[model samples]
Target: MLNIRCPYCEEDRPEIEFRNAGEAHIARPDEPDRVDDRQWADFLYTRDNPKGWHAERWRHVHGCGRFFNAVRHSVDDRILLTYKAGEPKPDIERMLREREA
Candidate 1:
């Protein structure tokens, strides 16, 4: 029902067209016991739950078979930006310009 941006096609695609993969840029600790409870908790539970400009990792399952980042707004349900898997995530305007170039 929601419209999600496909990082590959660089277009505002529907959510149904894509799949909801887990959090992005999550690196596990090298040593399990060395990591404290707070750190573990952060890895396990803490996520960027924001009202505006929330950065999340997404997979273009149906399109490019690539993973990228998306910046979206939760309150208004607007997708602000999208970027390639390795490309830097920027504001919507900057991302659009990067995609154009």
Candidate 2:
């Protein structure tokens, strides 16, 4: 059982409390119509599939009913960072300010 932190709920929840969404931060082309077939294919099919740390989008289903971001170490499934949805990632220095503010 993995331990997950839900930024919206502000609670340390179990992995069961959330659902694993696909790769986070997928950016679409600025001009969809201008994109060629090859470009579109690459964009749809290619993924980083990193071996080290990775950031993913997770949906907190059992908690605050919101989505958040998590930076986790892929090798051992160690969570490195978590932050609110659509907001910038949390920094140790600024995260404290976020908590205080």
> Against the hidden reference, what TM-scores do the models get?
0.66, 0.78
Candidate 1 per-residue lDDT over residues 11-90, each given as its tens digit: 87778667766555676788979989999999888887666556677887877777887776668766666677777556
Candidate that scores best on TM-score: 2
Clashes of each: 0, 0
Q: Give the residue spans of candidate 2 off by over 4 A.
A: 89-101
Clashes of 1: 0
Off by over 4 Å in 1: 1-3, 30-33, 91-101
